[model samples]
Target: MIISTRRIKQWLTFLILFVLFTLLLYQVMSFFTDMFEPDSIYKEPIGDAVKVFSDYGRQTSQATFSELVRERLLWFYEIGE
Candidate 1:
């Protein structure tokens, strides 16, 4: 099998752009999460997602997405109560 140089270059460019885009998106989401209070539905989910990501990095045990969502929701309800 033979691949063209131009095709390889295009694939590399696409990979780089995809990585940069993902990083930018994560930063933007994190910024909004930090900026907003967990008072409304929109803001709360963002904050929770940030917290979950942070926790995943910090802890020895890995948390599943469902577990993180459940824990965050429980916390939110407890705060409301």
Candidate 2:
């Protein structure tokens, strides 16, 4: 069986349009779904994610953040009280 050029063109056009329509529908549905999503729709107000470090940035000998650095420094110093 032989297919006509016009018929083939029409089928090609239909296939292209069908694929495009499916993609567009998918995008629209995704947009609406995102708009209505419980978590994404209503979120807490934007705020800084990092909390300020306590102790006012003062490095103490026993400070957790400075503990390793203090230990290294102590290794070089004489064991003096």
Best prediction by lDDT:
1
Q: After superposing candidate 1 on the true structure, give the runs of residues whose Cα lies further than 4 Å from its correct spot.
A: 38-81
In order, the Cα lDDT scores of the candidates are 0.80, 0.76
Task: Put down candidate 2 lDDT per residue, 1-81, tens digits, no spaces.
Answer: 997999999999999999999999999999998888787545555777554334535765555756755765686586652
Question: How many steric overlaps are in each model, in order?
Answer: 0, 0
Q: Number of clashes in model 1?
A: 0
TM-score for each predicted model, relative to the true structure: 0.45, 0.47
- The weakest ten consecutive residues by lDDT in model 1 span 43-52
